[model samples]
Target: MEFKLNLTQEQKLIMTQQMQLSVKLLQMSNFEIQTYIEKELQENPVLDAEYKKNDNDKAQDEIDYKKLIKHLEFDNYGHSSYHRDDEEVSPFNFISAKKSLKEFLKEQIIDLNETDYIKSMCEYIVENINQRGYLGTSIEDIAEELTISQELSQRCLEIVQSLEPTGIGARDIKECLKIQLIEKDLKDENIFKIVDEYLELLAENKYNVIAKKLKITVQKAQEYGDIIKTLEPKPSRGFYTGEETKYIVPEAYIKKIDGEYHIIMNDGTIPKLNINGLYKKIINNEDDKQTVKFVKEKLNSAVFLIKSINQRENTIYNILEKILEIQKDYFEFGDEYLKPMTLKEIADNLEIHESTVSRAIREKYIHTDKGTIKIKDLFTTGISRVDSIEDVSTKIIKKEIQEVINNEDKKKPLSDQKICQLLKEKNIDISRRTIAKYREEMGIKSSSKRKRF
Candidate 1:
């Protein structure tokens, strides 16, 4: 094979700075895009915001959401109602009302005890408690700072435990329940003994064994377990700060119009922006040299920006069309039908760079009957399963594990190894580590935690 040096008259377009700017603009959300346009208008005098009048211009812009929705709707089986109008849309309630016990402790410090020293000690104690609401610090450690006796610290702690929800300042689970039982006036010698001596058995759901050892009836043991369940194991949870409750506004809407999906930018909520015509007229005047130079610079920047904005829109539409082509299954079916995909897959399919695909989906969302899902959520790595089909996702694997556990015999619950074998038999060949991973992901406790007698 020999290389040919002869040149062909091929006119390949080079990627320009304007195109880069356009990509960046396309990645921006509606609010960000509006702000960008506003900034350009302020800086560029040559780029007038005024509407350019023409004879062929339409009188008004028409936006039809319903027609667009019809196009986005997936092919029907002739009589199915999966896209029913009355399906209750669960609006994301972003404002979380979690309150951890630390905050509860701080609040009570103000009203519970008037002594500044006691309040300071209590604050220190609250700060040292773990997420499970157990006091991680020692009474001796708290006593050192307040110049108080350990006895005083213990007394204050007892008061703290008595505060609310039955168990606020417990050092351990046993202590947490003991306090709760005392608060309910149900703390007996047997209850205290069970808390101190049978806690390990109690946690393992060995209620029968515990009852036999303690010479109590099985019903009595279960009644005690029920009381334990009612006690707040995580006493500090009442003061949890809900900083994670951030709201997101979708940048675009995908509607089905007559069985076709149409992408619509959420630009209507923002004010229409354009370069000022009067400003442009002032710069174009022939008499003023300084004004002309200043105006020319601004005018050039504005024109570049306007062209960039239009380019941005076109590029976004192109990328979204590609997304639709690949994720059509997701839009048509519910989340369960979503196939495993990734940015790299889309980029390779579209013959574009991965970064470009990533930028396109960043902070962007497609609003539909399914809800405002992040555009990026459509792409997920495939899970290695028995079916030659690369359709499984980690989410689905986790769900399968949960379903298995839910149906497992309570008396002989499946262990991690057992669960892995079950999954292998089902074609989802997951390792023990993967089984543990899915178990942890679902917030399901270990067999030990799930143990019930």
Candidate 2:
């Protein structure tokens, strides 16, 4: 046995707390960054909040609460006949209103002429309805929980189902579609049968199978399917709350000028940070060691934070520029022209790790003529075609598949195999399974489900 001291020298990358914070800040959305800044402002004495000025020469933080109250009164009550005609109306009297699905249903329930017991039951059912406007609890469960008869529970369920949204209170998607179809009173018997028994087949686009079962022409089956397509699948889709709102603030902008594209970083919204001048003065003149040490530490943290923000902005800018270069055709044309790209490719080109590129683009968006698009959306897996050396983007392939399905003959909707053939003819070598996967992803039914009778 031998024990000897062996010394080895090796270089390894270790991320400091400041560096980790920089990566986290780079990945945060603009809204999230603003929130983080506010939190930092509250905790760090060396950081100060900067308020932007409007054309009215008022600091944004100095809002007029009295004016806001006046506007609200003008909008809600000023137009009444009892109000004085001489009162001046402000042009900014309008206020946005939002109503949740439950509130809307409760309002409708209030209008019903049923007994208080029945109304309460219906209200309970409404409360149990999910955000998708489907019943979250089973009639049996509701009946047991409320100590009511099953028959009463069923009646209450029916009452809730008859609400404004056609598909409201359905137990499942099949029930939802059936409710909408029954409400429309469209004279299509096979539609009901398909919804009840052959929904799986209908989803697969098996029009031929439906035709065989219903003893009708493929065209008629297609007509029935088309009618079903008009029904709303999500009864509560438009009634999403504030949490569901997708707030996208782009960090960069790409503009086309004189036949060349230019990349511009969006730093206007980001706060420009600097160490508090007063704190620096305190540190320089303070005689107490403890006070000086405290100020020095805060100043260093503030400085590091500012540096991290600048680095994040630069790194993101460079990443966007490279992406724009690679996906120039996509920007010039449309989604159909989007080329295949990966985080690794960008990382290799930028001489950074793939994770760095990923973190830089995560939850970040860029503005273009098309619209605001997520940076991550630009990168997709490539599908290699037959005759070309270059690989095609899966996004482009999905778009092409959707187009093929949209233009397809309803009586004879193309099968996944046929889709593969069509794409192969255009030099895309996608397999049938991949084609089916993409088709399903796009919410397209199979040929059998698509058949008409």
CA lDDT, every model vs. true structure: 0.72, 0.83
lDDT of 2 by residue, 362-451 (tens): 888889999988889999999998978999999989988988988989767889999999999999989999999988888876787565
Each prediction's total of clashing residue pairs, residues at least 3 apart in sequence or on different chains, is 33, 18
- Model 2 stretches with alpha carbons more than 4 Å out: 1-13, 54-93, 115-117, 140-153, 186-193, 207-226, 241-243, 257-260, 285-287, 380-399, 403-441, 445-453
Winning candidate number (TM-score): 2
Per residue, candidate 1 scores C-alpha lDDT tens digits across 1-453 of 997789679879798876778777867876687677667656654444543343223311232336435534646534433232434211122224566556666787789745887777677777776766777888988888678899998887876666665676688787887887887898468778878898787776677887898799876887787677676766655455333545566767889999998888765544444566677577668899898888777666666676766666666677778777877877898766677778888788778789878887788777987898988877766677786666587667777898999999875788999999988888887789978977887788788657655
Choose the strongest candidate by lDDT: 2
How close to the true structure is residue 222 of candidate 1, measured as C-alpha lDDT?
A: 71
Candidate 1 displacement at residue 110 in angstroms: 14
Model 1 ranges off by over 4 Å? 1-27, 34-245, 286-289, 384-390
